[model samples]
Target: MRVYTLFTPSHKGLYEDYFLKTLPDEFELHATELFEQECPTGSFYHEGWDKICYRKVELFVAACEESMGEHFFYCDVDVQFFGNVVDLLVREIGDFDIACQDDVTAYCSGVFVCKASHTTLAMFKAMKRNYNREDQTTLNEHLHMCQHKKLSPAFFTYGRVAARPWSGERFRVPENVLLHHANFVIGVENKKQIMDYTREKNFS
Candidate 1:
């Protein structure tokens, strides 16, 4: 199986330091570094960040389409891993076209596995064709016909606020988490801080 991720110059370190370096040596890794002048660096959401988010979908779609007949895991650079989850996730792909983190309301585009079948390609193409606002919203609308699985238990996805109980937020993490995602936070530095904090708190 192949793993893919897209990042900017600011986030390239996450790919270099945590993603490629810390992860177990069990899979092939691929990354796309966006150099577009229009794309911003930070994780903060804005007009520029919106374009980065949509572009992420475009890059992911291209990677999956080119690798048809195989499975590719699209991961966000802003993450730290504690375990090799490829085998676990692959087993869940039994007959589904995709497997991803589910935050209850919508699919977390931050991390997912693409089976790259014809149906999966069509689904991705549809997202690119009918792109509006961003990727996750359009993905949820088309998922009615998508054969996908929402992953949990073995994976944990949360924001900076919830990771620290002292922040008055409930410390929301599974007892067995393969990795911790630094989503729902602004700034790449802030994300790195959260990823490091969670890894030390749980995986250390």
Candidate 2:
């Protein structure tokens, strides 16, 4: 298996200094930096998020094909890996075209595993139909049409502070999650602070 991620030029330092340090050495890791480009009207979400998201998907698919990897995992830069995620995926994601954490309303796209196949390619094509929608939403729509798996909540958790459905209290990061998604709810500086704290306390 292979792992992939995309980062912008502004966050290159974060990827090199922090995110790269958290990755296990068992699998090949690929990180690509985004380049500036003039996007066509209606081709992206606010501030080029959609374009980057689309590019990530395209690049992931190409990488899988080039490497002939059976499966590949893609994650946002804000995610920190705590364990050998590829091993966990091998044990858990059996025969699924894609696997992601369910965020109740939709599967969180921040971290996901995809199997290389015609079906996976078709799903990416379908997602391109709605470049204006959030990537998570587009992914959910296509996932529902294909064979996909949902990772257990214990394996993945969101770091964003929000109202919890179970207790109606603010959400908190659970202990020992394989992947922690520091979504855009908090600012980048605070996200880095949280990651630094977690690394020192739990990951160290």
Candidate 3:
């Protein structure tokens, strides 16, 4: 299997400084640095951000179309690795076409392992067509057709699990966290700050 991830120029620091360094040497990683001259925003849920999401969908579909592997992995640049997640994914994926991180509202498109078959190509292509909504919504719509699995949050975690220890969220900080996706907060600097502490906390 191969790994696929995308980041914009705005997030180049995260890609180079954290993501590239933490990844295990075993997997071949295809990192896409996307640039959109028109929409120069990185904050989520805004028009510029929505445009970026649309472009991200187009690229993901295109990349999956050309990939020759039997299974594919996608991770957002804001993510960090702490353990050998590849082994867990290989075992958990089993015969499923997709294995997703169960974010509170929906399946997180940020981190997932998918089969590189026509079914997945079709699913991602369908995601490309939903221009009005973000890519994750489209993923949830098409997920019903594919055989899938939801990875436990402790293993593949979200930043909220670490960022707000006082909020008393359902998911506590996992002591042996395998991966951490720095989301549920805004801006790159905020992400960097949380990731710095989260990585230090977990790595130690």
What value of lDDT does candidate 3 attain over all alpha carbons?
0.73
In candidate 1, what are the lDDT values of residues 1-204, reduced to their tens digit?
788888878788788888777676777877788877344545555547778778877976788777899988888887778888888888877778888776556677787887888787788878888886777777777776578888765667663234321222335455688876776667767667767767766854
Worst 10 residues of 1 by lDDT: 159-168
Clashing residue pairs for model 2: none
> Residue 146 lDDT in model 3?
73
Look at candidate 2 and tell me the lDDT of residue 143. Answer: 79
Per residue, candidate 3 scores C-alpha lDDT tens digits across 13-33 of 999888888888766888877
Q: Give the better candidate number (1 or 3) by TM-score.
A: 1
Residue 195, model 1: lDDT of 71
Tens-place lDDT per residue, model 2, 83-186, is: 77777786667877778876655677777877877777767766776543466777877776678877876554442334232222234456677666655434
Error of model 1, residue 57, in angstroms: 1.7
Those runs of model 2 whose alpha carbons end farther than 4 Å from true positions after fitting are 37-46, 67-69, 159-172, 200-204
Q: Give every collision pair in model 3.
A: none
What residue runs in model 1 are displaced by over 4 Å at the alpha carbon?
A: 159-172
Lowest summed lDDT across 10 adjacent residues in model 3 is found at 163-172
Please report, as a residue range, the 10-residue window in candidate 2 with the lowest summed lDDT. 159-168
Task: For residue 145, give model 2's deviation from the true position in Å.
Answer: 2.7
